[model samples]
Target: MHEVVAVRATIPGMTTTVDPRTVFETSGADLDAARAVFEQAYEASGFLPERTERVFGYRFRTVGDQTMSFRSTRFDARMVGEVDSGDQVSVSWVTDGGGVLDVGRDELGLSPGRPVVFPTGRPYRFELADVRQSVVQLDRTFLERIAAEAYGTEPGTLVFDHTAAPGVEAVRAWNHQVQEASRIVLGNAPVSVLALADTARRTALALLTTFPHRITARQVPLPTGATGRVRSAVEYMHAAAHTPITTTDVAEHVGLSVRGLQQAFQRQIGVAPNALLRGIRLDRVRDELRAGTPTDTTVASVAVRWGFAHLGRFSAAYARRFLEYPRDTLHG
Candidate 1:
């Protein structure tokens, strides 16, 4: 039997209230019924136990664009299938019990504090015994946008190095962040839109930093010419102008040493990379302020969104470039 509850969940950092459709309890002792229920609830494709008597409990909730779910099962089952993540990334952590997950030629042991990060298109096989877990799902486009703003490029593939052992401190910190995020998603805490966006951005950055990906590697080299290198760097700056990135990050992205990149910029662009980045960020801030409405949007928020942290400096730069105060532009 499954019980559905219509309850409003207060999302932390959201100004508006959201009513989430929740599945509070779902359980069945029969194998086929259990399999059908699981598939309907999670859209999971797999073969479950046919004869063994098992117990299952599931709870699911959604907040804005994200979903949080928990599942507990006390039976031996083989999940030889996949969840259609459909342009979303799913992160699951084992809160209790353990399991074995096999993806292609690799097999991972799922235990407490161990996280599995994967994009939605891959197929996985799992053998579970009395396992309980929590899962968090975020839109792929949202994360990609954040990555482009932060890294100046879109990630190629969201693949985690499951084979690599995470450090103790890193694992602990990641677990803490995940726990807090889960609480906000699952609990009834009133959240504002600004706060939600901030949390999502922080979570995406943390995931990118903690996980290993092909794009994050420093193996790719830029084109074999000064003009090409300078153009590439400039393009990256334009894409990531809204992010708080340093010149060193730009240099590293184009596969050049910091000093080499600086020299190239001087020779080709006649200005430093950091200066160009600042100019682009300033333009972005002006554009946003111009487009934003006076009631909901503020000059400080727009400036901060475009990576301008110091209000005084940001205002001075805006006045010098646009010949008007940012507040005037926003109001106008």
Candidate 2:
């Protein structure tokens, strides 16, 4: 059971009066004014949109609270939402122009007039300009129930590959109808709208269970001896992403001399171990920045965590590589 509440009440401890013109405008010099209205509306609804006209998508919103929100121009943009890894998921219909979605690692592409599901706990980035999309989140338990009922038993993992699946059209049509009904429920008795939402949720589960796009299973043949040892070392590095690891440590773990490890990494992974380590460090830094770590987690701390002792040089190198101030990124 879900509760669907009208999103019109003043946010707790915040003022409700805000300008819609600022929140929803075609385009103009009035953008700054619009931005103010947008900010206020976002805060009131608990979903803030940091949008550029060129990229008309909103991001980082919470369910029910509305952490992000947006609307766009006449023409729209098409995008896909995916549930790659998470406990819960929901499908949404509507995509195009200036809409943003968090799709994680699944390379699922959504054309216009398609419905997509975005599962929780996966990292995804989607960008589209000048469009609008209705957002929906699915209940994980509900989906699993449908999956068991439809497909004998649900696997530990399931893939919805749109290209391979034949039932995408049906799911799309069903999503459109659900979205329409949602609008009506939202406008009418908003308090009891949960009944309609629950129906949509159940329908979505049934549709997804039959969704076309089952990913083809591929076999990864394992290598023998030296090659396998080298592969294990590389895998270890990736798995220990947050730790400050060293090449000597890696070589010892893989039962190889330091020089041998260096040779193997260069020959196979095409990069030196230290260079690969730096790449991983840089990736970790980006991830930390995106996840909204504490402001006190400064650039210096980031560098030190990655094994860079010199603050000045580390900042310079980071700027040259990422094209932005390290401090700005850390704080932002």
Candidate 3:
């Protein structure tokens, strides 16, 4: 039977804590009961087990919150099943026994020291023969958003296509990174919000980098019309101001460190790059609001499209910048 332990899991990058308690724990020989537990543990819906013959011992345990999960699973049986990853992403390394995951196109052979993302966002099947594995489940939504932000693009572009690492060296590196992140996240000492958030971010970045994926180089916006770094940065801010680009992103685009960019902007433009970016985005928001209608779109929606998430803060900034409120401009 499943033991639902009530333990709080810390929000990544938030002032919270994940109680080190089991989220799911069960061990039984009844195939039907085991199947039910499996489905519940993974939050998986479409689980069609073809055969789980002679289930000698099956144990499952997981910890962590909605952001991520660390799971230990052992099934001593000839288990063959069709399972989906609940539209989430999972990476697992087989410590004992073996399995093959088929995404209805290609197959992934589960081996030791090798972590693989179960071909998700689609139907997949697996056959495990008396296996024990450690699994890390990541919230696809959180991970993808981080990925997109890192690349200065919107989410859902990058896809983890290959299941295996590029080589042996890559495999070892991946294992080390995962283990380190696991230690910080599932460790004894309480972690800082910054530490936890960085851990999660690094893990997500490592996962995407280690596995084979189609990711294009970020077209760091710079203009041929501009000569100096500060000028180029200004041009970039004006051109793609609505993008999810950050000060650091702008700095790198203009070939300067964050501090260097700040210094340059102060020297040349008498203001920080961030200030200029915010002013540009604010102007873009105002322009959009003035052109848009309440029936067509709301002021908050227009503001969010330009990276203004908090309505209260955005309203204050808009008023300070444009001498009027965002809603006033829209209604005008």
Scored by lDDT, model 2 comes in at: 0.49
Using all chains and alpha carbons, the TM-scores for the candidates as numbered come to 0.52, 0.37, 0.56
TM-score computed on alpha carbons, candidate 3: 0.56
| Residue-level lDDT for 262 in candidate 2 | 88
- Model 1 Cα displacement at 189 (Å)? 2.5
Better model by lDDT: candidate 1 vs candidate 2: 1
Instruction: Extract clashing residue pairs from model 3.
Output: none
RMSD of each: 17.4, 18.5, 16.0
Q: List ranges where model 1 is wrong by over 4 Å.
A: 6-30, 50-80, 119-121, 154-156, 216-332
How would you encode candidate 2's per-residue C-alpha lDDT over 144-231 as one tens digit per residue? 4556555676432234443343366566566655655445333333322354445545555555654543322212221233233455
How many pairs in model 1 have backbone atoms within 3 A of each other, for residues 3 or more apart or on separate chains, i.e. clashes?
Answer: 6
- Candidate 2 lDDT at 179 equals 58
Query: Any runs in candidate 3 off by more than 4 Å, and if so which?
Result: 1-6, 9-22, 45-55, 163-165, 191-194, 215-332
Ranking by lDDT: 3, 1, 2
The candidate scoring highest on lDDT is 3
